[model samples]
Target: MSDWKLFTDAACTEEFGGTLTTVHKTNFSDNPQDFVLYFANVAGDPGDNQVLELVEATQPGTNYLTMSIVDANVGSGHEADEITLATTAAGLDTAIAGASLDLGQDDDSIGVIRLLSGVSAAQEIHVRVENAVPNEGTSTELSSAMVEAISRTKSTA
Candidate 1:
């Protein structure tokens, strides 16, 4: 079905099916408040020009995320490729800025900007096309597993 997929980091190696991204808001602001999200068409494929939406899989309260996709690109070569997000508070504010990710580059990549404590990992997130869900919600989840198959992993180490 949909070739697009989601990952926890820019490298796009770790999937979000069973992982947790640390919450980083006001009071619970983690060190690197700016979480990076790179959700593209597929692995190393880059450049499909997609508009992805991420919602708490089950719609929880504690994990409700205010974070959004601040920046994205071919996801291959950039100064911020693997750099830790938000060395400073100002940077974090910039990372989690929007609600949707636009992949107009038409390249292969994967990543995300999510809430940690405010956004609970206990619930499942449904990644789908913009206003075009077939199986779940308004659109179908962006994965190949017939069932929803997204991913996550915020380990700095």
Candidate 2:
């Protein structure tokens, strides 16, 4: 029989799960149109693995918000796809501008962006959000805009 086991003892075991960390909040501005919301793998014990969750409370504009992950450290070479938001739905919409997605209003519209690989400590995952199409609006305000990092853990049996 194998020595490996799954946790059954409630007092002696810790759950194989993820921890949520708040990364960023919206601070409205007019210029630049594009901004870096959060830089992952920079601070804290962001756990061993992670996925990004973006929440926008209000509709920023009629256009979509594009999210991309770029190389932060040379030779570390983490691979992840860019996510673009243009409408109010949950899932991938790749046909639009290098796989763009929509950022819908309210709590119901939570965008979950999964990383291609688990980010190593000190290796950065650069996240940016930009207006796909500019409008007459001077400032963008969200009722509740924030980014969260959800850590991933492994389970054995």
Q: Name the best candidate (by lDDT).
A: 1
Candidate lDDT values, in order: 0.30, 0.26
TM-score of 1: 0.27
List the candidate 1 regions with Cα displacement exceeding 4 Å.
18-20, 23-32, 43-98, 106-157
Q: Least accurate stretch of 10 residues (summed lDDT) in model 2? A: 1-10
TM-score of each: 0.27, 0.21
C-alpha displacement of 101 in model 1, angstroms? 3.9
Candidate 2 per-residue lDDT, tens place, 22-112, comes to 2222342432122112122212224434332222213222223333333244233212222222322222232232342332222223333
lDDT of 2 at 90: 26
lDDT of 2 at 12: 16
Give the CA lDDT, 0 to 100, for residue 84 in model 1. 28
**Candidate 2 C-alpha RMSD relative to the actual structure:** 18.1
